[model samples]
Target: MHTDPDFSSRGRRLLCGTLAASVLPASLAPAAASAAAGNWPQKPLRLIVGFPPGSSPDMLARAVAEPLGQALGQPVIVDNKVGAAGSIGVASVARATDGYTIGLTGNGPLTTAKALTPSTPYDVARDLRPISLVATSPFVLAGSMAMPAADLRGFLEFAKAQGDKLSYGSIGPGSGSHLAMELLKTHTGIRAVHVPFPGFPQVATALMGKQIDLSFMIPSIAVPQAKNGRLRLYGVSTAAAFPGSGDVPPIQSALDRQRFDVASWNAVFGPASLPAPVAERLSQEIARILQTSEVKQRLLEQGWLAAGSAPGVLAHKIAEDTAMWGGVIRLTGARAE
Candidate 1:
C-alpha cells in the first residue's frame, strides 16, 4: 500500500488551479490557456469509456454526448475501450494529446484500481486533469431473500454470527463494490469470504439464486427486483436516499455509524496537457447540461444523481477517495489477483 509522497501536493495543485480559474477576472481567464483549443473542437470529439456499451458509465457518456454536442456545436462520439477495471479507457484519455479527447469514468479506474493494482498505465494525479464530476450513486448493499437480516443493522449482526461462513460478491477484485464491502467490515467487525463476479448482472443473478449471501450491487441491477421479491435490499452505502431505492435508509443511519459513506461516482477528465480554457469550457458546458431537467431525469432513470460541479470539485473528490480506498485496501489486505 505504498503512496506517492507528492500525491497530496499534486492534488492541491489540481484543486487550486480550478479555484483560480473560477475566480480569475472574466477577461483574463483564458490568457494563459493553450491555443490548441482556440475556436477548437472543429471536428467531432471522442469520449473514451473503459466499460462496455450498455454499462452505466457508457450510457452516461452517451447521455451527455448528445446535449454536450449541441452546446459545443460539434458532435461528441463515445469510444468504448474496455479492460483492467476501467483503467484502459482512462489511460486512453490521459494519453490523448489532440485536446479533443476526454473520458467519462467511474471510481474503479480513477481511484480504487490504482490502489489495488499500482502499475496502471497512467497516474491519475499526474496524467489526467479532471473536468467535471458528473454524478454519484451509492452502492446498494443487498442480500438474498432467504437471509435472516431484514435491514443493514440486522445484517451486520447476522454477518458477525456467521463469520466467514457467509459470503459476499463484488463485480471484480479492485472495484468500488469490493472496497465498499471491505470498508464496512472495518467499521462493523464482520467477516465474510469475498467472491468476485464479472459485473452487477452476475451478482444480481447470484443473489436471486441464493448462490451468495450478500453483495454490494448497483441500483440499475438491484432496485427493480423488489417487485419480484427475489432478493432483499438492505440499505444504501451513502447517507442519502437513492432515487428509486424506496425507504432504504443509509447504512450509516441504520446503526448510528461513523464512516460508512462509501459510494461509486462518475466524472469527466481530459489529458493533463489540455488547455485550462478548454477544460473550463467543457466543465461549464457539462454543468449546464446536467442542470437541465431533461438531463437530470435521464440520469435519475439510470440510477444516478446528476452532480455537475467545477473541475476542482472532481479533483478534490478523486484525491479524497483514493486515500480513503487505499486505507480500506490496506486494512483488508486486498491485493490484486
Candidate 2:
C-alpha cells in the first residue's frame, strides 16, 4: 500500500509530480474556455475507461464525470471497455469518430503496453489526441508477512535465493505494475515467477492471502492497506517519497543501480481527429473541475493527486513516456502475457 506517485513527462517537471503544479502558470496554456459547446459536444459525452470498475482509471473518470457534465451542460457517461491490459478500451476511444467520445487511461496502454505487444490496438501518437492528465500515483513494491524479508535489501537477497520458487503479481501483462517488477528482476537478477491479475484488488488479495509473494501495487489499492498495516511495503518505484509518509525508499538505492522510476497516471484523450478548439475547451474545463475542493479531496482520499493539465502537457508526457518505457521494455525484455 502507498500514497503518491512520480508522474513522467512535462507534468513531472512543471507540476513537481504534484497536482499543486496546476497553480503554476502554464504560459503555454490557451485562454480558459467560457463554454464547452459551440459546434462541439452536440450531445452527451461518453468517457471511456479501459479498466474495470473500481480501478484507478475508472475512479478518476467517475470522479469528474458529474461535475464535468454540469460544466458542459451535458451528461458525461462513463463507458468501461475492459481487457488486453487496457488497450481494448483505449482503442475504443481512439476509434470513435464522434468528438463526444474521450477516454481516461493510464501509462501501460498509452505507451509501454503497446511496446510490449506490437499488436496493441491503438497507436497513442497516431490514433489519440490529448486532453488532460487526471492523476498520477507511484507504485509500491509490497511483500507478504510470510516472506522472510522486512526491508527491500533483505527481500532481494531472499528472492535471489528462492528463484522461480517465488512469484510476483501484476494487474496485467503490460501494465506499469508489471514493468516495475520486471525492471526489478533485471536489477537484482531475481528469478521470481510472474502472475497476472485482472486489477489491483485481486493483486492485493493475492499478496495478502499469501497466494503470491510480492506485487507492485497502485496507490488506490496499496495506500489504505499500507496505512492499516495489512501489508508490508519494501520499496517504491521512484526516488521521490510519498507526501506525509516516509520510510519507503526508491528501488534504486537498494540495488546500487543508476536509476529506477515507475508510476501510473490517468489522463483524458479523444480520437486523433478531435479539433484543437474542442480539445482546449475540454482541457480547461477538466482542469477546472480537478481543482475544485470537493473533487480534489475525493481524489486525495484515493491516494491520487488530481492534475488537470493542458492538452499539450499530456501530449508531452505521452511522447516522453513512450520513449522512456520503450527503452526499459527493450532492456528488460518485458512482454504481454
Q: Which candidate ranks first by TM-score, i.e. highest?
A: 1
- Candidate 2 lDDT, tens digit per residue, 1-337? 1111433443344322222312323331222121133745557989989889987788899999999999888999999999886789888987776557889887777767666888887666666778899987778888876897888888888889996999899877667777778777766788889898977889998888988988988765776677787788888786777652357877878867556766678899887655567777889999999999999888878877778898778877776777667766776666787
* lDDT for model 2: 0.75
Task: List the candidate 2 regions with Cα displacement exceeding 4 Å.
Answer: 1-41, 153-165, 209-211, 227-229, 244-247, 252-257, 331-333
Residue 4 alpha-carbon offset, candidate 1, angstroms: 9.6
State the lDDT of candidate 1 residue by residue for 1-337, as single tens digits. Answer: 3455656785676566543433433443353233344677677889999989988899889889999999988999999999876889998887776668889998767777766887888877667878998888998988998798887778878888887898999977767788888888877777888999877889888989999989988887788885579889989998777867888888988556485787888999987766667888999999999999998899888899998887878889988887777777777778767
**In candidate 1, which residue ranges exceed 4 Å CA deviation?**
1-7, 16-38
Candidate 1, lDDT over the whole model: 0.81
Q: Candidate 2: minimum summed lDDT over ten consecutive residues — where?
A: 27-36
Q: Cα deviation of 40 in candidate 2 (Å)?
A: 4.0
